[model samples]
Target chain A: MTFDVEIVRWHAVASWTWNAGDDVCGICRMPFDGCPPDGKYPGDDSPVVWGVCGHAFHLQCIQKWLQSQAQTDQRCPFCRRAWEFKAAAPSS
Target chain B: MIKLFSVKEKQKKDAAAINNPKQSAGELRMQKDMSELNLAKGTTISFPDGKDKLLHFEIFLKPEDGIYKAGTFHFDFQVPTSYPHEPPKIKCKTKVFHPNIDLDGNICLNILREDWKPVLSINSIIYGLQFLFLDPNPEDPLNKEAAEMLANNKAKFESQVQAAIQRGAYIGSNHFPPCR
Candidate 1:
């Protein structure tokens, strides 16, 4: 008696999500794992950006939000503080 | 024992639901906003053009503690295709003797105009509208006559509001509908 099976190639499946505290972008209300309306792809195509205020939004979403504001009063949409991109990686 | 085919099919359906090709960005945003809306205590929303038409709706606000208390006011909300980016166009459908809301239903809420931001939701607008009824600002008013009356004499202003709500009476030359 003997077994008669040979393995060939393997298929793998995976999934991931950004570690941003909030699940969705406040500006576009889209999940961080997905891209905003203007973006064609998720993840790198619609990178999550953090403000100095600690709020996170899709890069494209925040850019549009900031552009909509007056030049002299560019503030974070969530907290009304000055909008400055966080230089460091977002903490868990 | 993973059912990969079924899982992938479900994922496809979900992706399509989230990003419907026919719907615009503004519509998607509005749908999200509406789903999370927490209306003020005395406020209720209704879609006149049916549930499918999320863009145009009405808000029935009945202030519980204010000069406008016991009066049911109707407000019309027109959310543009560029909403969230642009604040919804709100008008007081039921005419009243409000300083912030004029005879032509033009409202004087700051958030509805220059103060609006994409971060603000429909809930925020509802809260702002409710606040106006709670405390009508005579300083920044759409109804100049009402503002003058409110500033000059409190008792007279109160009577004018009563007259408009109870009898649909005229305050000076403008005819107000009985909204009680």
Candidate 2:
């Protein structure tokens, strides 16, 4: 699928303007955007994490997302889909 | 408005987390190994459960040449978190009577099993599967009877393959998933 930069930019700007004090990437719901200066969000090259709904996040961010929701229940913080670590097979 | 709402939610969640740092480190990783993926034409990927669930994805393989021409097979890939380090578990959800695939929908492909390597990508595995349909190997047989027949008698093997594919029962075995 072709990504429309203008559409993404417009959405990002609009989201920023309305939220006023949020640092989330509107599309991913994650706080990091790989842009410099503030750098609250982890830079790219961090281990990528995927939700059961197919959305992805940086490992650090997702771990934090999961930790935040620990009190209520165990579900994906974004989509609430049941999430589990894929079990690794024994190495030969 | 929708975009704004999502950003706000993210911020609220972030704030809530700062106050309570105790939570499960629930993390899942399912990125396809790009270096190993060797997709050919007519193969496509689908999320099915939106973009959030990448571990449970589907791949459509349409063979252009083989006894199973013009046929579409669906394979479900369940990638474990240790992917790239460990091979994803793949199963042929489509049922076809072949020497390499047993009646119970189990596939006897090497890449899916002992031969898997971190260097192999989704595309490479898919191509390997497609190759099985195009050229059913009898030497390493999952369906030993079919393999024996094919190895011993070429004509009988062809007849059995044709009969099974045409939705006809072979040797009292009734019903096969329609592939026409």
Q: How many clashes in each structure? A: 0, 17
Q: Top model by lDDT, which number? A: 1
Compose the digit string of candidate 2's lDDT tens values, residues B1-180: 999999999999999878874321111223324323456788778878876566668888878776766667788887765554456777787776678988676889887876554335666677788899888898988888777877898677766555655664554363555554
Model 1 docking grade: medium
Once fitted onto the true fold, the runs of candidate 2 whose alpha carbons sit more than 4 angstroms away are A1-92, B1-38, B159-172
Q: Native-vs-model 2 lDDT?
A: 0.60
**Which 10 residues in a row give candidate 2 chain B its minimum summed lDDT?**
B23-32
lDDT of each: 0.86, 0.60
Query: Candidate 1 residues B40-128, lDDT tens each?
Result: 67688899899978999999998887777778999999898877788899888897888888878999988898888888999889889
Q: DockQ values for all predictions?
A: 0.52, 0.02
